[model samples]
Target: MILCCGEALIDMIPAPVQTGGTGYVPHSGGAVFNTAVALGRLDVPTGFLTGLSKDLFGEQLRETLGNSRVDTRFCILSDRPTTLAFVRLTDGHATYTFYDENTAGRSLFPDQLPDLPDEIGALYFGGISLISEPCADFYAALAMRDADERLIVMDPNIRAGFIRDEDRYRARLDAMIRRTGILKVSDEDLEWILPGPGPLDEKAGAIAARGPKIVIVTRGREGAFASFSDGTMVTAPARRVEVVDTVGAGDTFNAGVLAALASDGLLTRAGLEEIDGPRMKSALEHGARVAAVTVSRAGANPPWSHELSGPDPD
Candidate 1:
């Protein structure tokens, strides 16, 4: 099973109330949470590892997970307040304003972490968990500790707005990248991490040099590209769809890729290292398929396994 490690929070999404004015509505989401939900919905044997609260929103997040069939045995429960993200969408894009101080997901300590079960063949980490304080340090340490024992996948999912210390965050990110086996990235995320003066491949190469056997760079509607440590590369075109809002496109895409990898027996470190162009292409297709379903709807809701066989958006 793939264990997703990161934050869990409630997203206050904008909606049109009866007054014909905009108001906020709560939804269960967080980068890692979104991916875990997507994985479960796709019928992947997935579990979540994170700090969750006992608050109403937290309970709601928990219920969402349970409903989606995600294993929650690894969660560290607390009475701490749940993190809240107020998301604003312009056209079909999403931006956010977060109120995350001292929340359950952000205040995690290393001791709170449960010993990972051996059944977890791969671990996925990303989002604010890599930049948020005490928890960030704890997560980095956990990923580093298990780097050699299992497959490690990371999607920096960098949100420049949330980073508190540039140098320190960069150091933590670089360290995690070194330990990552499959580093899935968006073109935008790449610019944020490896800023300026070169092409996308060169930037990905720098990270690949640090360790990751395969670097997957996604370009929204254009498609995605994968760079291997062996110096080979491949690309996949994104599926066309009517985007309602891009709330959890990247996270669902991560789930799709993992699901595809798991189905192809390439969910392990050795399989990733030996991944070929066609296999990478097929995985990217899965990611695009899931993502297409996500943005075609409202909020961060991804497709159910059976939903994929339904009607087309366009």
Candidate 2:
């Protein structure tokens, strides 16, 4: 099972109401939450590890997990309020304004972390949860601690506005990247991580040199580029789709790559270290296909197993 560790919250998105005014509608979302649900919907054995509130929004998030077939036994429940991110869209792109002070998912302490069982072969981490305090440290520590035993996959999904301390966050990310087997980042994320004067692939390569066996740099509509630690590079083109909104596109893309790797039995620690160009390219293509379906719809809703063409990755 792949255990996704990070924030899970409600997204209050804008909608057109009858009076020609914008109305906010609540949707269950968060980067890690989206990936976990996407994995579950794709029929991968998945589990979620995060702090959840007893609030109504938390209940909605939990129900979404259950419906997607994700295991929630690892969730830490509390009376703290749930985090809410209000989203704005412009021509299919998305922006978020978050209200996340002392929320359940942001307040997780290291002591509250659950010990994982043998079934969890991989651990995925990312999003604003990595920017929040107490919980960010908690997750960073968890990822480093479990690195030796399981495959560690991370997509920082960096949101610059949420980071309070640039130095501290960069340090934390550097440490995590050293232990990460697969590292996925956006073009903007790559630029921020290694700012100034370098080609995208070179910058990605620099990151790969730090530690990750595989470094995937997603280029929005252009698609994704990957660099393996063993000197192999591959690229996958984005699928052409009439995008409705890009809410969960990257999150679902991460799930698709993982699912494809899992299907090819390359999700294991050793398998990742020995990954070649073709296999990695195949995984990226699969991710593009999955993400295409996500962008073609509304919200963070990823396609169900039956929705994709060909044999199920599960």
Please report the candidate that would top TM-score against the real structure.
2
How badly does each model clash, as a count of residue pairs?
A: 0, 0
RMSD of each: 1.6, 2.0
Give a tens-digit lDDT track for model 1, residues 190-226: 9988788899988888878889989999998788999
* Model 2 misplaced regions, further than 4 Å: 310-314
| Candidate 1 overall lDDT versus native | 0.90
lDDT of 2 by residue, 168-258 (tens): 9999999999999999999999999999998999999999999998999999889998998777799999998889999999999999999
TM-score of 1: 0.97
| Residue 55 error, candidate 1, Å | 0.7
Model 1: number of backbone collisions: 0
TM-score for each model: 0.97, 0.97
